[model samples]
Target: MNVALIPFDTAAPSDGSGVRRALRRLPLRDVLQLAVVAKVEGTATLNDVSRELASERIGAELQRAGSPALRRRSLQILSVGCEGITTPGGWLIASLKAPAGRGFGLALGHARSAPVAMHDRATRKHIGSAATAVRAAMRRAGLDRKAVELVLIKSPIRLAGGGPHVGSTAASRGAAALGAALALGDIYESDLRDGSLCTDWRLHGFRAMAFSGTETDCCEALVMGNRRGGDPLLRVERAVLSDILDAAPLAALAAGAKAIFFKAGIGRSGAVRGARTTVLTSELPPDKQLRAAASGVVGAILGTTRAFISGGAEHQAPPGACLAAVIRAAD
Candidate 1:
């Protein structure tokens, strides 16, 4: 297996030049999945035009490369937003795999779900759609439930006249996480319903990291893990942060990591380990605050600000906690 991370700088809002440059380095086939984590100038309060254009450019470039994994099977994601210390760049990730291997290697599979209607944004329908897609990706990756390490989801938030649904983003993320959990056997289908989203803090996918955006109308899932006959050069490890201030586990995981992905949440209590937090009350959006503050903590541990950090974790982790994963060279 071969995994590639191509980073590029974007100079303007909704710029595709950087993404084009990055895609030029990728080939047309054998790619299990592709994902992008970009820094946006606009916060979630407004519709980010750049993010939409950048996502379109990525799809166009992939089509030009003759890759058949566009809207059908490839898990393509465009996560836009960079607050505080987050850098104004993005990483283009691609994973290629083969059939022969003696030891464990990174295995990847991707699939796109049906387009979700606005009314189904946080409903059981959304969860079912995501679960189906996740299972499909897992099959393609040749990994069973236990072999899967991470399920990175890019889900759509409810849109009203091209605008975001006030508080629907978290609900969408929660639905995505529950879907992943159902597919991975972490939770049963019976555990989920329309009312479970955002309110069922106890239900979550420990390995799931969901991000909601307006750039997509459907759900895309990237299933990653170590397969017995997969690539041996790289391995992935995941840990849960008790809270935003929980940095010790991250420090231990970054020893030789080549890439890191973090999903931050303000927790259900809107506090940090029982301390009152003004994140929910401040004028700034809560997502921005969590992303910025978590970026600082993770950056300090990894000694680099280039890590892929996103907010609005939902059911990806425990409320008020964070989820982190690292890809490092295998010993």
Candidate 2:
């Protein structure tokens, strides 16, 4: 797989300037997934349209590039939040022709859901839609349940009229993760219901890193793993953190890694490793708090602050824990 990081450089994500430049660096037709991570500016009131505007700009730029991959609508995740040391930018991950080599290589594929309705935000309909899309993405990636290393999901967090409903972002994220779990056979469909999301910690996706934002009403799924005949230069590893402070696993995995992404959770309880934490009670958004704290830990280990760390890890990690994935050169 090929990865390119492009900076926004003070430009609003809606401008499409960054994406246009990124297209030139990548083999447009081979591109499979795009993620937009921007910094939060001003009050995050209903007027914030960064996610929606960025999505449209990205789609237009991809279309203009004449990428055939758009035939299936390449997965696009537009997330707006760069808490702590995280930088505002975008990542274009694509599959280019592999040079002659003989090791397992990174493979990526994606699928998008139909627009979810307001009432279906956290309901069974939303869950089933996400599950179906995830399964389709896995099929496209030529990966089985066990072979898939990570699943990145973008779920809707806003109402049609704008703004968020009570706990909408967390609920949507939980539902998306549960859907991934169901698709990967980690959880059963019978265990799912409207109330199952954000309420049942046991039903979680081991390989999912879900992000909820105002990007789009539809759910987008990106599946990544190692497959034969892919680019042999790259490989990805995934691990679960006991908590944000669980640095030993990351220390082991960060060696030679080119990219790192993290999903942090507060878990059902407000405690971390037997210690009571106050993130849940902090006046700041809990998701922001988690992102900032996790970024600090990951940056300290990785020796860089450019890691993609997102919060609202409902049903994606163990209680008060985090999920991590590192893409690195093959041994």
Best by TM-score: 1
Per-residue lDDT tens digits for candidate 2, residues 1-331, read 4434444433665677776787777665555555444443222333567666666777787778755555344567655666788765546666554354555778777888888887778778878878888998888777889889999887875465443344477877887888888899888988876577767777777799887776567888888888875557778799988888889988888877877888887756678778888888878878778878887898898887767778878888766778999878888
Residue 269 lDDT in candidate 2:
64
lDDT of prediction 1:
0.77
Model 2 residue 237 CA deviation (Å) reads: 1.1
What lDDT score is found at residue 123 in candidate 1?
79
lDDT of the candidates, in the order given: 0.77, 0.73
What lDDT is reached at residue 265 by model 2?
Answer: 79
Residue 270, model 1: Cα distance from true site in angstroms: 1.9
Error in Å for residue 318 of model 1: 1.5
RMSD of 1: 2.8
Error of 2 at 108 (Å): 0.9
The Cα error of candidate 1 at residue 44, in Å, is 2.2
lDDT of 1 at 129: 88
- Window of ten residues with lowest summed lDDT in model 1: 66-75
